[model samples]
Target: MPSDYHHGVRVIEILDGVRPIRTVETGVVGVVGTAPDADPEVFPLDEAVLIIGSRTKAAKLDTTGNGQGTLPGVMDAIFDQIAPLIVVVRVEDVEDENEQISKILGTVDATGHHSGLQALLTAKTSLGIKPRILGAPGFSHHQPVADELGIKAEHLRAFAYVDSPATTVEEAVVHRNLFGNKRVMIMWPAFKVWDTPLADYVYQPASARALGMRAKLDNDIGWHKTISNIVINGVSGLTADVSWELQNPVTDAGYLNANEITTMVVQDGFRFWGSRTCSGDPMFAFESAVRTGDVLADTIGEAHMWAVDKPMSPTLIQNIMDGVNSKFRELKNFSYIVNAECYLDPELNSVESLASGKLWLNYDYSPVPPLEQLGFRAKLTNKYLVELLEVK
Candidate 1:
């Protein structure tokens, strides 16, 4: 049947133009450690990688009898503080430190199969998700793993949380100075945390706790804030409390802070008391600055993926510049940056270069630096009454 429609009816429509940039997920942690159920026959050790969303999922995969090389503790420590997604890469458990290191850095077999760290790297590539933070809490105080993870982080444009094999402040500072890289941050002195299933306090790496704290900071606030002076949850006490005042000089804490090695101290409760990267370059020494720069770079890179292989016209270039400048202005409005400038010049985008299908973009910005030092000044005055009476 046919019917006549009502006259003078109005219809409204909306259109979306110029796609905005997408914000990348921050503080996703990638953990490589040992798990009993990660056997070759059960979970295919060569390709053993899982994304755990909650503590319950982690408990199911933790088949270790004594809860060693298990993910429940780390998961509990992380999820108890902040809710961030985690990727778990399980490697075979070995007693010998050298053998474990060897396994993590896998070698190609006759059948062209890789194991251990190599396998995890392969899985990471295949999964197509890059975690912004990396940690390996199961391998306590293992420097080799930290080194390899630092290399991976440099390639992946991420950050790593490394644990120093030192129990005292002096030893930790010495150990931290051995490696100088911007992508890694060193933590010291394992802490004892109560385990419900074990009914006892077990010492665990401080890197796990640091990772959780960073995650919480990212969730609660922006990445421009430092992770220092924040209380660490899920821990009772440090294995050895390193005092900043008892050192050779009272200023040794400043030295430790300069070296990028953070320590646990007793305040009202245990707290993380430093924020710096292991980079020798003083420009990027602060961990918060490094993270903010990374976030900016990643966001810009992902946002420009749509312009690839497009026509190299002036309109196209202007569109790209406008999009980038818009994002930076938003950051400035949010107080993440002092100001940002982006442009392309003839020197960078020459006629020959443009003809050869090449384009260049240059941007500069300053991040909000953390207040590592605070000072207060006071002056004594004797004529307070006379000064007050003369104001009118």
Candidate 2:
């Protein structure tokens, strides 16, 4: 505080205005599942344990050859795509299959302990990172579990990848009807990979592969980029033979994508073919769009901690506005947003609200959506030949 009673010559550096906001990583995956053979000391029941770019101890996550647990194989699948931070919440692997579903769904005990999907809520507080990408791998195929995942994703400003039954394309469409949420994307069939532990080929859930793909896209590329069309590695084949045609929409791959169920396709090798979420709303159809919005909102919101409880002044208000606009430009340069503008509206910030030290800053941004379709009319005409004849 500068007072009138300040004696001689003293300098007060006024620090108020736009400061670059900290950008949170958008690729941290929080997965919930069983790890029957995992060291209980390492991955306690219902505790959020962080694993960063290492699998020395991850081997302990399962030793029974992926027989009882889900997390072991899923972790391997995610690591196959890209090494990103993973927050695992392990639950008890019970005898009853239905009990395993309940465990994966998790519960907040009366003592305030979080388990299952609920354990992800404490990821930020306990592990200093929030998982913006989430999944349950084997368990997410269960409708209730997937719905619960959607609920948790909304709370954490995260996105969830859910698996679908591999029975048929129609079954995948029916699975899509089981859930509809912008935060949740449904993946169909499963990916087959060589399981050295079992000396046989086993299927991994599409949701688990999606988790890895998303992490790679966010880390290697910008978060605004789409997860589709990228070549998937460490996969031999898909459990279902998803047909795909470059210029046709009447294929199995196209049908699954049309119904908002993401399926893999074989191109040069195998590629993730779909970009749509389970959302019925066209506005949030694409996972890339949802993620772009999440990153912007989370980064901007977390960056404003310095402004809290500070004296509101014109300089401070201007600083806030400029900070947001500047961030928009930076993100636009990185292809995170198409374009963005920030402004203060008098209608939103009323005189009374300002008097009460509340000011409303408004900004709008358009996310870069995935290119699902591209078309150029192939007109067979003499027009091009006429030009060629003149040149000759």
Top lDDT hit: 2
TM-score of 1: 0.87
Against the true structure, candidate 2 reaches a TM-score of 0.96
Q: What is the lDDT of residue 162 in candidate 2?
A: 85
Each model's lDDT comes to 0.74, 0.86
Model 1: runs farther than 4 Å from truth? 1-17, 37-52, 107-115, 119-125, 244-252, 385-392
Worst 10 residues of 1 by lDDT: 245-254
Model 1 alpha-carbon miss at residue 29, Å: 0.5
lDDT of 2 by residue, 59-153 (tens): 66876555458888888888989888999999998989889899899899899999989999999999999998999998888888989999999
Model 2 alpha-carbon miss at residue 102, Å: 0.9
Instruction: Please write out the lDDT profile of model 1 over residues 1-392, one tens digit for every residue.
Output: 12456567656563223558876777677777766653344344546355545655666556554566645577778876776767666677788989987766566689867575545455456666666777777663677777877886776677888888876778888888778889888887788899876899988888887777887887788777777888888889878856664333345455667667877777677878788889989888888778878888999998987888877777788888888889988988988777887898778877888889999999988988888777678889786867767865
Which pairs of residues collide in model 2?
none
Estimate the lDDT of model 1.
0.74
| Deviation (Å) of 288 in candidate 1 | 1.4
The window of 10 residues in a row where model 2 has the poorest summed lDDT is: 59-68
TM-score of each: 0.87, 0.96
